[model samples]
Target: MLALVSAPTNLGLRPPQPGSVPGASKAPEALREAGLFELLRVGGAREAGAIVPGRYVDDDATRPPGRVRNESALVAHALRLAGRVGTILDAGDAPVVVGGDCSVLVGIGVALARRGGTGLIHLDGHTDFRHPGNSGACASVAGEDLAVAVGLHWPAIADIGGLGPYFAPGRTAHLGHRDDDERATEARDLLGAVVSAREARQTASATTAARIHAVAGTGYWLQLDVDILDPDVMPAVDSPDPGGLDTGELGALLRELAPRAIGASITVFDPDLDPDGRCARALVDLLAAPLTTLGSALR
Candidate 1:
């Protein structure tokens, strides 16, 4: 069974303007309005309800070194979201978390870390690998989640609940990052596997699956940042770069991976940029099948 969890948070993103909030926070609602919930319900999924995050605070001016924007709030939300996801997992239900942004990975990491050994399959257009080791400007968890998940970050965010290195670098596979990403080559050296958007687009799903199988432990988590889709198809994200998967390619990859994933999270869609709801509808269409069919192999 699959449980749909709503995680509406934008704390990890830098504000579009100093005083303005990012629209990614409105993603879950927009997706629901686009009939995502109803489609999943009809496909035999149940709603696990929402994990409302603390209000976003623009604290960059006062934040200390190593602290990201809304750092405390982001951690709080992750702990709470972890609790929710843990409950769903405890009941033996796969969770499909629809969220505000990539920062949600911290909470998912917390939950999975408690369960002991687990792997991760990260799909995104950017590496999200910035950390203290690579950049002086490491203020956004959204951009640093992969680094945090693998424990290449400060202890505060990475070691929540004393559970650090949520997923070991050897157990994490990265897919869909553009070939030209600044950190792609460096990330390739540390991660379990690196399949760029260019490669994923050209390779067979079965071949990609085989590569992922090498690093995916007995079980794994699927993290999807919808910006993995081409900017032409999914420009509603905060950063939509070209050289990403098209709708069909993304869905194919998801269908192959979801059946083996214990749980999954979809993030980084900004409703603010999607004025006519076309992106939401497209996202709903893209996610409907895979979300409903997660963990089917186990059954």
Candidate 2:
């Protein structure tokens, strides 16, 4: 079974300044408007209902650059999201989580960690290992998804459920990252292994997926960030980087990973930029095709 978990959030972003429009918090509704949920339902996946956060609060983008923004609200909502995920898992459905930002990983990571032995397959354009408090970059937890997941960032987030780290270093795999940001500059004592975009392209996506599965065992949580797509094709992201995969490339990659996923989350697609909805259509197709494959494989 499959369930769509909605985390309509921008908390993981730097929070909104006074006049700023929203960022990825608009993703779930946008994709739904594009008929993603209805299409998935046609494949027999159920709309398990959106996991709404209790409240949302964001810091101004002007906060001291290196300060992690909205720490309190972020932690609180993550706990709430974790419960939602736990409930879905208890019902025995693999949750297809949609995100507010990468920060939603806090809840996903925590739930997986508590359940024990679950590994992570992180696919993104950037490494996302920066902990600004330690690395001196601007503080955005979305920028620190990997670090936070492994108990290297905020104590409230990383240490959720009294678990120290969500995924042990060796059990996690980071893939498709271009490594163009502060991630290149930070020291990665907490991250264990990674399969870079260049390395993945050097081989087949199947090879990379096999390596990820080898590390993760029978099940893993898959985190797919759309920014990992080439900017020419997927420009509706908060941070657009080049030298990444296209929608077809990502679909091919998912052909190997989707069937193995215990749960999955799609993040960082900003519909605000795609006024004509072209990107939204592409995202729905990308999501539906692999998910259809996943549903069949599980059956």
Candidate 3:
């Protein structure tokens, strides 16, 4: 059976307020309404639920303190969710998690790591590994989430699921990264063997699939950040960069990878930034392919 989980909290960055942001509030609803879970449930899916992370509304005066609490809350929530999902996996069921941001990977990585050494296929425009004191044009915590998961920044993200160094360099691979900030560059240097967007474009989907399969060797988790798509093609994102994979290419890659990898999860961010639901729908379609397989298998 497949257990679908939803984490609707944007921890590192705040999702734009409803009505103010074009499609933010409706993104999660769209996922649910699109029959994402219903499709999974069609074949006697074991369980499903949406989790609301504790809100830590950003405040200037209490920003520092708030971040401390917010990170803790996010970690706690992730651990709780991981434990729940782990329980399902222990019983031989696959877990599919829908997320509000890439930060949710902290928990997912830890949970997967607990089962065994799991490989990572991180699909994003940026490496998402900001060091503790790294300064950049956009100094946002969201950019550093991958670093935290990999144990680059311990203080900020240490206690999530008691899993440190969630993934090793050899166990991790990146695809569709077009833009690189200083922090991202540092992360790439620290963790070698990342496939660039140009390379992904030059390489066929089959080649990409082979590379991921080779690197992962066996079971692995897929961390998808919607910002990896071209801004023109997917305009709604907290951090949109130009020159990313197209919908068709991305869908093909996911479809190819899903069957090869042992387990996987996806995260969608900044849906509020979407203007006309173009990005949201595209994301849903991209995910629907593999999810349908999961549904069929469990059914």
Candidate 4:
């Protein structure tokens, strides 16, 4: 059985500028409305409920500038998600989590940790290890989820579930990161067996999975960020960068990886940007393939 979970919090994104729709929060419903659940019929599935943020206060006196904005709500939100995901795992069902953003990974990490330390597979275009800024200006805490999970960021998030550094440095593999070195410098210091986009091109997905699994050992959780797909095919993200794998490449990777994952989450596809509904359908089609195989394997 598979438990379909929804996390609709966008506190990780840049705050809405007036009338703009912070579209990521709408992803859970959008995906369901697009027939994603029906298309990938498993033993069971349902929304895990949404977590919209409330209140924002600057705490520059204690926190680094901007890191404190929505800090309390986001941390509490992750714990809440951890509880929900823990229940899903305890029920002996693999979790197919849909997200509000990458920050949801913190909660997923928390849940996985209690099951006896798990490894992580992060598939994204950007390294997403953007350093927590010291410029006294607000930087996104949401974007640094990987950092937080590994104990490089705030202690509050890193220490959730009463465990620090959810995935060991040697156990995590970050693949398909095509972003520049400057953005990933801090993050690079902490990772292991990171496959760059260039290296990923030369290596097959199964080969990559084997290398990652060797380190991950027993099991791992897969984190899929939609922005990892090329903007030409997945242009609905908030920060679409240049150069990414096509859906075919992504599907191939998922097929090789998903069956082995204890749980997985798909993040950052904004329905508002996909005006014609093409991206939504495309996402469902792409996910349905491996998810079907993954569900059966889990069953």
Candidate 5:
């Protein structure tokens, strides 16, 4: 069975403006309002309640030198999120986390680290690899999740609870990054498996799944940043790039991947950008089938 967890937090993202909070914080409720919970319930999922996050504070101006935006708040949220996910895992249910931003990966990483040697299938439009080593624009942890997850960033975010390098690079697979991503070449060299969006479209879903499974690791976690879908189809994300998977392609891939995952986190769908709820409905429709059968392989 899948346990639905809502980790509605936007602490990792830079505010749209100085005083405004990132709208992604409302993603969980928006998805619920669009009837995602009902569909999942019909598919035999139980709601696991929500993890309320700390208040969003745009500390950009006053942020300490080595810290990202909302550093303390983000860490606090990840700890709480990890605890909830851990509880769901202990109960023998796969968690399907509805998230506020890509930084949710940090929490999931911590939870999986506790279990020992779980791989990660990172499905995102961008590699989200910018760290202090790579770029000076490191304020948004959401933009650097993959790096942090693999312990490529500062100790504060990466070594949460002293569990640094949650997923080893050799055990992690990155899929759906654009061919032109600045980190594409480096990620290919670092990660066990790296598949570009274009390559995935050309390859069979099973083949892609096989590539991920071939990584040197045990059970894997699936991280879905909705921007992996083409901006033409899913423009409501904070960063919508040009090239990405279509709804059908992503759905097919997820169907193949989800069942093999121990748990999955869905992130980066901004309801504020989807005012009419069309995007939310589309997102729910796209996810319902694949997520409904999440972790089936384990069963």
Candidate 6:
């Protein structure tokens, strides 16, 4: 059985005009329709105010307080969700988490790390490894999530899920990265390999899957941030970059890798930025293909 965990509370940061965002309101529904939630029960932390703290951009009064109550709540919610998902995984259940933001990765990573050494296949446009003291082009909490997961930025995100140093540098692989900012330097320093978007575009999905399989070895988690897709395909992101993996290519990669990996999870942020919900539906469909395969194999 595969458990579908929902962490829909956007506690870390709230994007601009969250409520008005088309897919933002219907993420849970989309997941349900995709049958991603069929096997497992749903759980999450309490919803805070609608307007939360803006990690990357300035705050907007129009949003609800649910955006920003406290960082501790976000961490607590993640820890709880991770604990539940970990318990399921231990009991032979595959866990696929739907997200509030990329920060949910911290909880999922912690859970996978506690069980054993887990490789990380991070798909995103940015490396997200900014340290506390380091100042660069993009400096924000969200930008440093990857760094925090690997114990690069201590104290700020250390308490999340009660797991430190989520995964080894050598066991991590970054795919579909096109944008480079200040955090890029830190990522290069910490990550084993950062695969460029160009390389991913040129290479076949099967080839890319093979590379990830080789690098990640056994027992890995798949963390995807939708911004890795081109703005034309996924414009609802907090920061959408140009030139990203197409839906078909990404689906093929996921399907090829799902059975090979030990466990996997995905997170979608700023869905509210997508008014039409087209991006959300596409992501759901792409992810569902592999998830269904994984669930069937597990059964």
Best by TM-score: 1
What RMSD does model 3 have? Answer: 3.5
* lDDT (C-alpha) at residue 30 in model 4: 90
- Candidates in order, TM-scores: namely 0.98, 0.91, 0.85, 0.88, 0.98, 0.79
- Which whole-number lDDT from 0 to 100 does residue 234 have in model 4? 91
Higher-ranked by lDDT: 1 or 6: 1
* Candidate number with the higher TM-score (2 or 4): 2
Better of 3 and 5 by lDDT: 5
lDDT of 2 by residue, 1-299 (tens): 88888888777775445656457888999999998888988987887777665454555644554346677777778887888888888888888888768888988887877787488888888988876456756467888888887777757667876886888877777877885555633423444457666777778877777777787665778899888898898999888888888777788889888887888999999888899999999999888978765633554
Model 1 lDDT tens row, 1-299: 88999999999999998888999889999999999999999999999999999998788788988788898899999999999999999999999899999999999999999988589999999999999999999998999999999999888899988899999999999998887889998889999999999999899988898899789864699999998999999999988898999998988888888888889999999999999999999999999988887888877
The whole-model lDDT of each prediction reads: 0.91, 0.78, 0.66, 0.74, 0.90, 0.62
After superposition, the stretches of candidate 3 with alpha carbons farther than 4 Å from their true spots are 14-26, 43-46, 65-69, 133-141, 159-162, 294-299
Off by over 4 Å in 1: none
Q: Please provide, for model 5 over 1-299, each residue's C-alpha lDDT reduced to its tens digit, 9 standing for 90 to 100.
A: 88999989999888988889899989999999999999999989999999888999988778888899888888888988889989999999999999989888888889888877588999999898898888988889888999999999999999888898999999999999888899888788898998999999999998888888899343589999999999999999998998899999999899988888888999999999998999999998999999987888778
Cα RMSDs, all models: 0.9, 2.5, 3.5, 3.0, 1.1, 6.0
lDDT, ranked from best to worst = 1, 5, 2, 4, 3, 6
Evaluation by TM-score, superior candidate among 1 and 3: 1
TM-score of 3: 0.85
Candidate 2's error at 153, in angstroms?
0.6
For lDDT, candidate 1 versus 5, the one ahead is 1
lDDT of 4 by residue, 1-299 (tens): 56777787676776556424468878888988898877656525544455454544433345554354567788888788888888878877777888787888887887777766788888877776654442233355556767666766656667775787888878887876675634565556667767766666678878977887786654578888888888999999988877788888788889988888878888888888988889998999899778755534445
Which 10 residues in a row give candidate 5 its minimum summed lDDT?
210-219
* Top candidate, metric lDDT: 1
Give a tens-digit lDDT track for model 3, residues 1-299: 56777777566564354323222323456666656666557755545677677755544335453243256667777777677667767877667777767777777766877886577778888877665556432223456667766776655464454667777766777777775544556656656357777788889889888877787655667777777888888877777788888888788888776664545666555555654666666776677666555423223
Worst 10-residue stretch by lDDT in candidate 6?
A: 44-53
